[model samples]
Every structure is written in C-alpha cells, then in structure tokens.
Target: MGSSASKAALAATTEEPMEPGPKHLADLTQYINETHMSVAHLADILSKKTGSSSWVVVFKALVTVHHLMVHGNERFIRHLAARHSLFTLHNFLDKSVGEGYAMSIFIRRYSRYLNERSLAYRQIACDITKVKRGASGVMRNMDTDRLLHTLPVIQTQLDALLSFAADPDELRNGIVRAAFRLLLKDSLRLFAAYNEGMLNLLGKYFDMRRSQCRESLELYAKFLARTAKLTRFLRVAEQVGIDRNSIPHLTQAPCSLLEALQQHLASLEEKKDFLCPCGLQHTVTLSIPYRPTGNACARRTWFADYFPYTIFTLPSPQACWSRAAKYGASIETDASGGTNWQLSTCASTSAIWTSVSGPPSPHTVTSTMAFPPLMSPQSLVSSPPGLMADELELTAWAGQQSQSM
Candidate 1:
C-alpha cells in the first residue's frame, strides 16, 4: 500500500500532462490521509521529486506539498514537524531551462516558507507559542515577554513570504504555467494572514508615550527595515498583471503604521539621553553580599561594616530607553530619610549604541494568473479562522494538514 501511494505520487507529479491539476492533487491528498505508512511513503517520494534536477518534477512536488498542507489531514502536519522531516527543499535548484532557472528561485523561497510555517505550527502544537490569537482573528495586545520570543519568528515568516517577490521575472516566465497560478493564490492567503499579524503587533506600540519599551521598539525597527522590500514586491505584482483591487491585503499593507513606528524609533534615537555606552556595556557591580570594591558597589553603598544603605552613587547616566542596563544619577538617602541624586564618578571605557537603519521590505507577493479587476465573495479565498494562531500562533490552525514523513 505504501509503495502504491509512492508510485502514484511519482506518476502524478512526473508523468502528468502540464500540472498535476485538481483531480490528481485531490487524489494525492487522499493518499496522505489514508494511513501513517502511506504518509511516510508519500513524503519520501516528494522529497525525491522536489530534489530532482527536473524543474517540472520540482514544481509538481512543491505544489503537491502545498496542497497537502492546505487540504490534507493532521498526520502530514505532524510528520513535517517531527524532529526529522523529509523535504530539504530550502537550497533546491534546477538549471534545465530558462523557465526552470527562474522558477528555481521561487522554489527555494516557497520551500523556506513551508519550512518556517511548519516550525511555527509545531511551536503551537507544543504549546511553546508565546503569543496566542485573540477573538478578532489577529494577534493583538500580547504579553511583552512572549512578544520577545515570538515576534522575531513572525518577522522571519513575513520576510520569507514577502521575498517571493525577489525574482518576479523568473516567475513571470512561468505565468502561463500552473505552478505560477497555484503559488499566486497561496501567496495571497499568506499575505492576508502575515500582514495582519505584523500590523497588530505594531498596534501594540502605536502609542509611544504609553507603550514605550525596548522590546517593542526593537520589533518596530525590524518591520520598519522592510520598507524597501515592500516597494520591490509591489513592482513585481504590477509586472505580473495582478489586479490591485482584487488583493487588498498586498496593496494596503500597514505602511502608515510602519511609518509611524519608524518616526517613533527615529525620535528616540535622536534624543541625547536615549543611547549611551552604559546601556549596552554597563559596569559590573558587586551583589549585596560582595565587598564594595573593583567592579563591586554597595547595595546602598552601605557604610559602617560595609557602607551606608542610604548613601550611594546613582547608576551612571545612560540611554533612557535602554532596558537591558541601568545608568543614571547616583541615588542616596540623607539623615531625614530623603533620597538625594548625584552624578556617577565611574564611567564606561567605550561608547556602544549607534544609529543603524532597518532595511526596507517590498510587500512582495503575486496572485492568480490574472486577478479579475474586482473579486466577488466566492472568488476570494476565505482565509481560515484558525489562521489567527495566538497572533504569533501564526496562521491560526494554518497548518491544517500534517502527516508523518
């Protein structure tokens, strides 16, 4: 039975006329859902197909995997998330023809997207996900600590999805091909989910005066860097003949919020007291139990046996925004029990914090061979409600299909 499914997958992907088409894709998906052995056998076949030198095989194999992800059952998803998964299409390449060469680029991008999508899903299945989805179908008002762990992963997925725009010419060459059409639709759903996720996270930091935090600021900067990337992506979309109106998510990405975030980041960077050496590289001070000498300071710079608890230098002045280190005026208490502030006698040996600009991202994504000037309710793919995965749960139950590989 396993061998049968493997052979069927190979034939459907390699021997089919043109693309596998919907019939074959549905048949293949059924095979994945049949049994554990069938799932493993099918996965092994796909890994081989995608890794082949033949571009057609790679494209068919990738499409099959994408279909399985969307339409197959849970077994396949777990198979992918297992410690050892089958496909290693990340560095896949094909040099058979001009179209293959061009298509190879998107193949790599797609593979990376799949790999990231799988891992993020695994994070949720494992309950290791820091951010959880809210009722509005997007990640919002997340715990700050969890955002630190989850935000970067979200950015990475966004970058992978947006990067599909990197070489539109190659894809343009495949525009008439089915793989192009399939990926285009898949990318649309992806854009809607990820773009909404990025925006909601930005919403967390929308009010700088109230929501200011080093972690949130870092997130804003990360998304801000993609400004240029977004521009390139849109250019490719226009070149591919996609109807802008048909795809509101791609066309109406949260640029205004990104700009607002950038403005806030820049404003902070511009402040004289915003950044300093001590923030990144602070002096090592002794804990309360250690002697107050050489890299050691009293808890209050306590006097008597060690030093007085009330009289001590405030932390040296450092960036006001830096959350990692504390450097400011010395804090001490006088006889009346009132606190007094003074400048720190000690200083950092070197300066650290400096201006570094985030690279811009073009909202690079393509859709359908030719999106109608306007889409109807039925024409639009309803992104699954589960795609709201705890916000960073990323794509909700987006990884609906999972089989053992």
Candidate 2:
C-alpha cells in the first residue's frame, strides 16, 4: 500500500500543469458590450451633472466611441459599418463630398480649440494663486475655485458646439463617413500636438540645465519606441476592415527634435571640460611611468592604458600625421647632417596628454614627447604579439573599467 501511494504522488508531481484557455468568443462579445454600456452610462451622468451644453461629456463620448471602433472585434465593427453606411457613400456625390469637407474643417478647428484651451488652462493653473497668508488665499483653495469656475464654462461652450448623443442619428445618414474622417483627423492632430508640446518642454528644461530633463527625455524616447510597435497592430486593424490610411500622417517634428537633443547631450558628455553639479570639471586621467617615444608599439601601449574604458580603433597614419603637424613637429636635418625631428606641445596635444595623465599638479613636469613616423595600415595590423596583445588586453580592461565606473 505504501509503494502504491508513493507511485501516485510521483505521478501527480510529474504531471504537466494546465494552462489557461483562450477566452470564448461569446464572453469577449459580452465584455465589449458591457464596456460600451459603461462608457455610455458615464457620458450620460456627466451630461446630466454638467448640463447638455457641456462639451466635456461630448468629447468623452466621442473618444470612447472611437476607441471602441478602433479596437472592437470584427463582428461589432461590421455591424457598425453596415448600420452607418460608412464605406457605401461615393465621394463623387455632392452631398457626401460637401459633408466630408465640412467634417474635416470642423475637426481641425475643434483640435485647435482644444490645444489652445489646454495651454491656457496650464498657464492659469500655474499662476492662479499668489503667495499669501490667509486660509482662503491658499494655493489648494485657489485651485479648487479655478477648477469649479473654469471647467463648467468650458464644458458648456464645448457641448453647445458639438453635442454627442448616446445613439447618434448622425451615424445613420451620409454623415457617418464624415464622422469617421473627423475621428481619425482629430486623433492624429492630438498625437502631433502632444509630441510637439513634449519637445518644447524638453527644450525649455534643457536650456535651463535642469537635472529633471534627463528623466523626461528618456521617458519620451521610450514612449516613441513603443509607439513604433503600434504600427504593426494598426496593420492588423487594417486587415480586419478598419481604414488605417484614413488616419493623418504622423509629423516627424518630435523624432527630429529627439535626435537633435540626443546628439547635443552626447557632445556635451564627451567634452572633457564639462562641469558636473559637484562644481568640478570632468577630465580623463592617464598615468604612464615611461616617456612617450617615436615607436608605434610604445604609443599603442600608452593609448591602451589611456582609454581603459573605451574601445576605439587605433589612430590611422593620416590622423597621426595631422596630430604631429598640429604640434608644429616635422622631420628635418640636424646640424651634423643627420635626420632629426623635434616636437612641441600644442593645445590639442596638451589636452590629450592631460586627459591621459592625472590632474595637473604644481610639481608636474612637462617632457618633450616624440612623435612616431606615419606607418601603413598593414604594418600596424601585422605588429608583434606584444604589441597586438594590447588590443586583447584592452577588451578585458574595458569591461573591468566600465564596472568600476
């Protein structure tokens, strides 16, 4: 009996766990319907509370409907298309064309209005309260009054302009095409505006040298990267009968702004004299016990140690020549008629050497470093193991250096 019980327990332990099954189509349909009802109910409550003249309710309803249409299942979408005659109307028809154009204009104006109001609201919110002693004059109290007074007025005006019905009769007429067009246009404009606003804010913060700008920039970049993935999902939506092309083209302003900011920040970071918040300038320190010579191997070894944390290709022959020329060094004949060369320190050379060595000190001695003659790329590649091992050592050293940093 004991042996049999143990066998059963082992069998139970070895059994594969059951995975959750996919949701049933009926359950999904019910869920979508319930969500739609919830949004509709919320809109109704808002409309009653703020009055039928409030645009806030209308806007919320429109956004909810657009979300449902965009993300809804095929059955619900097909029902909508058929019920609304969305794609059946010909653009050549005078009524259809006129309504479509009117819808586009209305949407554009609405988007502009929203943008202006949002900016105004932000400004007002920032400056509504002055520093004061009284309880009534407190910032929080002032904000509450601002919200109470401003929101109802804005909502009323907005609602009067574009009142949304729970069951929109506009959808049954030729206006459905116009409605879809407006939805798509508005969505694109809002997205563009959001990106533009972020770009402007980032620029402002960066100009002020605010530390918070870094976090904001990173978050914005991450959002953009995630948005790129949405394109694939949109393609799938198109396959399921939604007209993805009806959406307006995304503006490149945000991407361009991000790229420019990234490049600017990178350049700032690379500067050796860039000041940190601690009130000290950043500098690379290289300590070499041996003096630099004309030999390529010695120079390569020095560089390998100098840039311990970075992996970079060895300077080409032309680059070496350029550096030498910048330092006013040249090959010439000596008084004894023998080949001779002299090197002097230039700004670039001094900066480079300073970065490699420790911070400047009173006792620091300046020595004349020899510049190596330009060698072909092939010779640099075919150097001895001792010289070649510098590159290998660099790979290992770089990892360790990075960990420490």
Candidate 3:
C-alpha cells in the first residue's frame, strides 16, 4: 500500500496543468471589471486635478479606450459595456471643450489602435453607437451606415468652430480644437473634390487633347491650376499616412505650372496675337513720344502714357541724356563726336533714347531710352521699398482702373 501511494503521488506530480475553463474566465472578467473601475477612479482624480476644460481628460479617456479595444476580447468589451464605460465617455463628451472635436479624437484613436477586421473594432463600434444613441435619439435611429454618416456632421461642426472664431486669440486658446479643425478641413474638402469620377474625367480629357491648340492649352492650364490647388490642400491629408515626414512635391505645383505655361505660350509662333488669361499679350509696349532740342543742355519734356498694371514710366529726355553722358564717359566716341550709350531699363522690354540731328527737323527728333533695372515691376512686386511707396500707389491705382474697366 505504501509503494502504490508513492507511485500515485509521482504520477500526480508529473501531470500537465489543465486549460482554464468557465471558472477562470469568470475570474478574468472580475479582474477586468476591477481594473476598469480603478482606471475610471484614476481618471476622475486626474480630471479634478486638471480643469474640466483641460484636454488631458479627453486624452486620458482616449488612452483607456484604446487599451481596452486593443487588448480586450469580446467578453472584456461586454464587461466594459455593462459597466457603463460608454456613459462615462458620453458624460466627458458633454463637458468637453469641443464635443465634436473630442469625438474626432476618439475616432482617430480607435482607428489607429484597432484593425477593422478585428472583433474589437466591431465591438467598439457597437458600444459607440449605444453611447451616441443614449446621448441623442437621432443616433439611435441610425443604421451603421447612417451612424458613420454623422462623422461629416461632426467634422462640419468642428469646421464651424474654427470659422466662427473672431481672431487668432480664440484659436490660440483652443489649440486642440484648432488643430483638429485644420487637419480635418483640408482632407474633407480634398477628398470631396478629387473623387474617382472627377479623376476619370480629367484623365479622359488629357487623353483626348494632345495638340497645342489654344482651347486645349487653356483647358490644360485650368486643369493644372485645379490640380495644384487640390494638391496643396492634400498636405494635411498626407500627414495622416505612415510616413508623416514625407511631404508631397506638389506644394509649389501651381507656381511651377504658371511658369511653365508662361514659357510655353512665349515659345508659340502665334504668341504675339494670343491673349493670355491674364488679359495681356506676351510682349507689351508703351511708347512716349518726345521732341529733342538742338541745345543738348536743354531739358526736353515728354508726357508718359499710363501703362496698366505696370510701374513703367518714360524718363524725361534730360534724364536720358544725363544717364547717357554718365555711361558714355567710359566708352569710345564715333568720328562725328557722337557717343552711343546702352541703357538697361527696369521694364523687361523697354528702351529710351534721344535723337540729335544737324539739319532741319532736328528740333523734334524722337529718342527711345531704357531705364534702370531698379524701377521694374517685377522688382517692386517682390520687394517694395519705403521709398517706392509712390510706385505701389501707382500700381494700386492701375489695378483699380483695370478692375473698373
């Protein structure tokens, strides 16, 4: 009998442990319930430590939900749901600084932590529906698709929050809400604008137009401009991708396309007659006729015609002569003691000069002169100096006149 008892004891010691059954699962559920309560209590303490308006509450709750969704199975989710975790979330949502904004944060966190194919997503979705329905009867009536449709409504509310701010101070104070609004606004608009149908249409249009015809080129320019605008807005959308640091090269696409179109139009043989979308030809000329006196010392006056949307002005014949004399001193003179000076003007394509003759009709000789590069529209547009306030005034006046026309 002692030998048999020893053998049985040895067999028992060698036996493998049995798998956990219903009793173990019940214990696990109890443990999860206790853990969830502890987390809720901690969150309440933290919320009291931080102000109710503080985003910390929202962040902490999001972390809790993420943990539960990622690690907890269906039974754990059911336990959380039974403990009214959704009600806690709903209460937090109500008191939060931006309710819609907070919801978006929750959605993004859930999407990041739980895979759609996983049971956790579906469980969380159901719990979210329940919480949403409890808060609003409208959500209770909604099917899953309809419930998902409310995401845009929340997005629109967040956008309205951003738009309604009177100044930057309001946005500064609500940085979290502002960030959510900015991040969502561009993405929503871009996705709506660049749908599959629009893409297919654009592709077909491109394939149909291969020639350099004016209509085709005009359409191409429009397409490029639209594409550039959409692409620029997509910067925020692309931030949500796995590689956050990688920025798309299309940020400056509009500027590049404009420059390219300008070059292409300039290269065309019929460019002279082609009226650009900007309502100006490739080359624009403004002539100011002036009469020159026999006495080279005399200050000849010329009236400048106003050039639309340009800072260009015709210099007086005396000014031209002064510039010529200044430049001519460094150069060689011809046999007739006449000096030719090459003048560089601010206008991309303008020249000014004086004509002197010894015979009759020499009194009113026309002179074409070029001004300095400093006075060009491009330079003024780029960096208008304090001394160039008059030029800016002229440009503004010209712009008003053109708009009125």
Candidate 4:
C-alpha cells in the first residue's frame, strides 16, 4: 500500500485528522472531548495519517497531549482519559525510555514558561504519568524518569529549532531545545556517581542488563559532551530571560546517593554556570580520608586520601540518615556506642568503627556535617522527600568523619 493512503486509513480508523491547521486542532479537541479515546485509538489515528505503526502514533500522541497540558488545555487532557482507562491510555505512551525523554523535554520546555497558574497544569501532567509501569508492576517515578525520557525530546527539539536559525525568537528559545545537551557533556562525572548508585540498587528487582547499563551510561556522557556546541545558542536564550530553574539540575542527581563517595564539586561546577568538562576546573570541595597517627594527647591533622566524593544538594537528609541507619542496622548493630571523638574530625576521614566479628573490614561510617554553610543539622532537618544524593553524601560523610577522628 502507498504511504499516504495507509496513513489516512490509520487516522480514519483511530478518528484523528492527519494535518496541522485550525480544523485539525479543532477536530482533535472535539475527538478527545467527545470520545475520550484510549491510547490505542490515538495510536491508530497517528499511524493511519503518518504511515507509522501504532507505537509511533501512540508516542506522538503522548507528546501532543503533554504539549496540550502544558498549554493549559485541561479540557483536552480530561476528555481523552475520561473516556478510556487511564492505564490503557498511558501504556503506549510509556513504551520506552525515549518516549519519556521526549515528553519530559516538552514539559521542561513549557515548564520554563509556567507562572503560578500554569504550575497546576505541570503538576497534573506529572500526576498522570504514574499510570504506566513495567512488566514487574513497578511504576517509574516522574523525578527519576524525567531526565531519562526528556533527553531524546531535547535532541529532537534541538534539531527542529536549528531549522529556524533565521528567526531570532525561535533562536533565543533554542536553549529550551538544547536542554539535555549539557548533560551529554561531563557524562563521566555524573556517570561515576550514577554507576555507584546503580551498583548499590542492582539486586532490587531492577531487571538491568550490563549492556543496557553501559548504553545508558554512554548516552548520558554523550549528552554532557554535546553541550559545548550548543552554548552560543543557549547564551542567546538567557539574554531573553529564560528561567534556568524550570528544568532539574542536569549537573547533579535529581535524587540523593548513599555512600558519600568522598568527591566534592561545587554547585557552580554542575554545568550550570559556565560550561561542561572544562566546567570541572572550577573550584571543587575535596574530602580526603585521614587516620589519626598520634597519641590521645597529640594534635591530629587530616591526611589526604586519593579517593574523592563530589557533594551535591540532597532533598532529604534525615530520611537518608534513617535509611542508611536502617541499612546499617540490617547488617550490624547501632554501632553508635563508643566515644564521640569522631565529631571533631573533617568529613573525609570519618571511619572509626570496624565490625569486631572478624578481620577489619573497609566499611566506613560517615555523617552529615561536612557541608559548611549550605547543609547543617538545622538544614538537614528541613529537606523534603526525594533527597538530593550529593548533599546527603557530603553531610553524612562529614558527620561520620568527625566522629571517627
């Protein structure tokens, strides 16, 4: 069959118009409102018009619906889901990590334009995303999946925006198009941290393969590296006053980490300030492991350990500590029984406790006192859920290191 006829037939079956224009938009609005069709219906419509398969149609429909939501078309969003099972509506939308990435890029894009009123729409879009899941029945959290999904969209948008280099307004907003580019750069720094977390979480029903893990890691690194080529375009966006905060931090983890890796990179280093890779040259906070060499009366100085952990903001400190405490408790006892001397030591050197059951293991106990100004017992007490991994690691290491010393 010829492509156009096939596409038309597909759209006819699903009941969506094939072209972009006023009538097309109006018909889609009416179809969504009046029929409340499921994702399968939307996919069928898209496949018929585009000669693409049901999968592509469904994916495109998700992006379209998300765009509508961002544009404050709640009537459209509600109309579609109200008619169909929301889970069935979302099944095709969440097929792969790339679809998620594309939708997220659009969200992050329009989210930049959100005022307080539009934030409601943004929240609704986020809430609706919970409907889909993997075969294991584990639904991916929006925060965790946001970047993974948005990266592909960011690339697609960037390519489209590049086609409009002649138009300054489109050119200016191109930073929105290039959102994940910075992440493609400096992939190693983020990947190192990412790997540590994955390794820690691997056995917990994640269903990750080594190849998938490596591909994911490489994709992330490439995104970080590509940011450089797009910098000039981004600078133009900033001149027009785009809100950088709309998107989550590309340089740091969207969530928190457990083992304080003893590496510290300042917030500015996070591809946010200047650029990537070279951005690492910016001032970084370093933590070195130290062991006391002198007697009880002697003054001890912290010695440098080659291993480093970069610190970033953590959303929840107490929760992290609680979880860490739980994990520690699972393997051993409270272990908080001995002298409190570790309190005065630098965050890097805090590893005093050894499991007395056998040979001295390398397991170290760190706390959350290292952050000089940003994170304190006072601050740690206040963080919301979804802890920032870097900040938690820094605070935990600092607190633990002090006690060890």
Candidate 1 Cα errors over 4 Å, as ranges: 1-4, 15-17, 33-38, 83-86, 89-100, 124-138, 166-169, 172-186, 195-212, 225-245, 249-405
TM-score of 2: 0.24
- Which tens-of-lDDT digit does each residue in 135-173 have in candidate 4? 221122223344344334333333333322222343232
What's the lDDT for candidate 2? 0.29
On TM-score, the leading prediction is 1
Candidate closer to the true structure by lDDT (higher is better), 1 or 4? 1
| TM-scores, each model vs. reference | 0.53, 0.24, 0.20, 0.29
The global C-alpha lDDT for each of the candidates, from Candidate 1 onward, is 0.45, 0.29, 0.29, 0.29
Superior by TM-score: candidate 1 or candidate 3: 1
- Residue-wise lDDT of candidate 1 within 1-405, one digit each (tens)? 666666668766873436675666777777777765537667777877776887677777877776787667866766777736655776766766666666677777777777776786676452122223434643444444555566666666657656666555555443224444444444444443434445455444433343444566556445434433443454455556665433222111111222223334455454323322111111211122222222112311212222111111112122211211122212222444332212122211111122211222122321101000111112112321001122222233323211210
**lDDT tens digits, residue span 1-405, model 2:** 323323322222221221111232223334455543323332223223222222222332233333333333333333332332221112211233344453334333433333333333344432111122122222213332333343333333233223221123233332233333333332332232233333234324334232343544454454343333322222232343444333212111113224333433444354223221111111211122343443434544543333222121355434433443443332232344332221221100101111021112222332222211111112222221111111122112222322221
- Clash pairs for candidate 3: 345-371, 351-369, 352-368, 352-369, 352-370, 353-367, 353-368, 353-369
Off by over 4 Å in 4: 1-27, 36-220, 226-279, 285-405
Best candidate, lDDT-wise? 1
Per-residue error for 331 in candidate 3, Å, reads 39
